[model samples]
Target chain A: MRIGKRSSKLMMNLYQRNKFKIRATTSNPRQGLLVATFLILVVIGADVFMDGAIRSRIRPMLVPVASFGRSAVAAVAGQDFWSSRQALLNENESLRERIEKMEAQNAGFEALRDDYEALQKMMAVTDEEGEKGLIAPIASSFRASPYGTFIIGAGFTKGVREGDIVLSEGGFVLGAVSEVNAKSSLVRMVFAPGQKTEVVSGSTGFTISGRGGGNASAEVPREAALAEGAPVRASIYEGRPIGIIGNIESASSSAYAEIHVVFPINLNTVRYVYIVPGNE
Target chain B: MSNMRLLLAILGIVFVFIAPPWLTAMCILALSLRWRAWEVLLIGACADILWFPGTFSYGIPVVTLFSLVVLIILEPLRNELLVDRRMI
Candidate 1:
């Protein structure tokens, strides 16, 4: 259906009026707020999605940012660690000096005690082992497989040899050298497997075999007059207390009396040992 | 179009595929140079779809419809803001 010219002119005027109204409404505050909110939401979503894509290449640009944060934290922590290390070193040095002083005093006391023991053993007058002799200091340790041994400072260089029994500075029977090198020899401790000896407690004077006992104590016959807190000496060429009896086993036909002796010296911790090279 | 604007638009499209971030500043610049907003945005969306085909291809119709609606709202305000800043 065709409209007349007058009607067509009226419709065109109305269309133009609507267009102008639309343009004017676009600038209203309400419309501006809606547009601004929509732009913000779109930009945020777009940025979130785009950030992932850009990050693959933008990593370098972000490095200085992350490093700035890390370095600040590290600087604070590093200062604390440096000060703590300095304080620790000062305490360690002071303790070391104190330890050295104590060790020197201990050496002098050890010498005097050894002399007193020698004099006591001398006056006993039983005289079963032989003449007493001064024990010399051990110099070095020997390490080998299947057989653990140590070397003394005094060897054939000072007339020590194979088959000679070595003693600790306290006159404890440690071991005898199974093999000898020029300046050092291998000492097999008496408690080593396959080694045995006769031992006597104080004045009991009965011979007991030195079957190997581990780091724990040894078990001896309970009714055989052994008691707690008694010194046990080994009878091998000379009498020396290698271990002390700590406890006696409960009396039962099934068990030998057991005692825990603190090893006369810590075998693993010993830095120096002695060898008594006698008239050989 | 002048050689400089055409070169810039081409460079802008290539970089959008190579790296989509190149589109944002470029679109703002293209608008500043008096290029039609639709032309700049159409070019940008097309280049963007090349890199992210899964999201933008099947997704293009939606984005296009949305972008046109946004462009219609934004064109007048952007024009006013730029004019206010003496950038026009």
Candidate 2:
């Protein structure tokens, strides 16, 4: 009993020696917020103080953990939990998703076909015309970055380079490669927050700025005829529809109306993305 | 470590990779209030390092920077708010 009390006192003494005073009866000190701040400082210090040597050295080890986290999430999603009703609901949801994906992809292919035909009549064909780009598995969390960026499993070794256009499974424009590493690359979303792209809404052309999380918004003259669910096509994405118009807001005092656009596919469900060589 | 702090720390780490940014931020915030949870910064750093594009990219290490700022801001506030409990 005495030993236990003495050890408790000793432990109490140890905690009391820190810089920040905690309200212990014996006057122990606070350790401060250590977990997030300490590691964050280490990462920042590695970048600023050590020229990123520590992060570069330690990143490879952490990659697997990130991958495992992704896989674990996938596995959990794939589970049925022994509930037949839930399973059926999931199946029905997936089927509806597949149909929407197919319809959107078909529309994209028809647009591409028309564009190709027009180009064929205008100029000689290049060698890379029909070459399909590489598919890379998503390595990091889409929810992880505040900058609307994500990492792909394939990188420099897989022929991925900066400025490569990334595409969804249904050929929707996703983003472009911003950074390439040995076995991983970073993709900055076309609809990244504050990013801009020229898009056509019906017959009207205007600039849309990304609001992040697979959404964007643009202002059009209140006199223009536009509707919700109309596809917005961007020239940078090979004239493909980048997103569909979602919501419209107009005020009596405003000259222009606001339209919020949404990327058709939910980024969370995407497991892989295709990388295409960007045109110079 | 206090059991509450330990559990909060574990959740903060787990949420960084799987949960939404807001959710993870909330978890970290809850953690910072209970204990001087430095581990939240590590989780934030790990997240920033993994997702942040290299020096060539346009992204800011937002998680780390935000957590640092939060910790700094909450330090005095927590001390003052929890003064009654500190008497124990």
Candidate of highest TM-score: 2
Poorest lDDT segment (10 consecutive residues) of candidate 2 chain B: B79-88
For model 2, what is the C-alpha lDDT against the true structure?
0.72
Which stretches in model 2 have alpha-carbon errors above 4 Å?
Answer: A1-42, A45-59, A82-129, B56-59, B83-88
Candidate number of the best DockQ: 2
Worst 10 residues of 1 chain A by lDDT: A140-149
> Among these predicted structures, which one has the highest lDDT?
2
Q: Is the docking of candidate 1 incorrect, acceptable, medium or high quality?
A: incorrect
lDDT of 1 by residue, A152-269 (tens): 4444566666667666545566677654544444466665433345667856554443333322345566666766667777666466676676666676665566655544555533
Every model's DockQ, to 2 decimals?
0.01, 0.49
Measured by TM-score, how close is model 1 to the native structure?
A: 0.36
Off by over 4 Å in 1: A1-148, A202-219, A251-255, A260-262, A278-280, B1-88
Give the range of the ten consecutive residues with the poorest summed lDDT in model 2 chain A.
A121-130
* Model 1 steric clash pairs: A138-A273, A139-A152, A139-A153, A142-A150, A249-A257, A249-A258
